[model samples]
Target: MAQTSASPDVATRALPATWTTNLHLSSDTGLLQEGLDALEGYRKKDPNKVVVRFRAIGNAPIMRQNFYKITVSNRFQAVIQFLRKELGWKAGEPLYTYINMAFSPAPDDTVSNLFKSFATDGHLIVNYSTTAAWG
Candidate 1:
């Protein structure tokens, strides 16, 4: 069968900034905590290696809701893959994302550069809304 050029029927509503910048990593809290524990293991195993962390962003840990943040002295790749590949998280879902790098300006900042790194760097902050997932 010949492949056809296709277009969507409607325009998509854009997500806010927070979703894109920091990585949410996992939708499930237990998994997120597991990842943190694994990081702790890494800290013990390789004390010399740079330490990275997935710290909770909001004041409370909201159930069934994605709310978190992460910090890395270096080695962003390690944590991104651990959550994205190993954990089998909310990836491939249409999730709302907000991205910025420490005081960077947004609102039409052209996130192509940011988007490239985010393929593996970003966290799954806000949980996936079905409309965002599959409208």
Candidate 2:
């Protein structure tokens, strides 16, 4: 289909001088400051490798080498898979892993973020159990 284009004269027309001059302005500077603070809070500088300490919960078997170092860019699922391999757990078996015995991070959560938020004494404590051990 043939399309008609705007005339050169019409295309070059400028907007009214007052159109941009009278634009609404916000008087609340506090909101802008809060937004800046929030942005600063969200940014976290991560290291190349994160130290992960695996701890047994309840009747779960303990890993001989509790401390394992992994790249910061890895996701939480990689940690879970490594634990399962060490414990010889099948794919369908129930494995509950938590950070600092507090909460379970999502599979897609980055190791760097988890380490940044929950690492203690330069190690990220990961608790594991065959069943639910904590709320």
Which candidate tops TM-score? Answer: 2
Among these predictions, the greatest lDDT belongs to 2
Please give the CA lDDT of all the candidate structures: 0.36, 0.87
Cand. 2 TM to true fold: 0.65
lDDT of 1 by residue, 72-116 (tens): 232334334343432344667432223332222233432233333
Instruction: State how far residue 41 of model 2 sits from its true place (Å).
Output: 19
> Which sections of candidate 1 miss by over 4 Å?
1-47, 58-75, 85-88, 94-135
lDDT of 2 at 72: 88
Instruction: Report the lDDT tens digits of candidate 2 across residue range 1-135.
Output: 212554655567755768555345756688679879999976655558978999999999988899999988889999999999999999899999999988999999999989888899999999999999775
Clashes of each: 14, 0
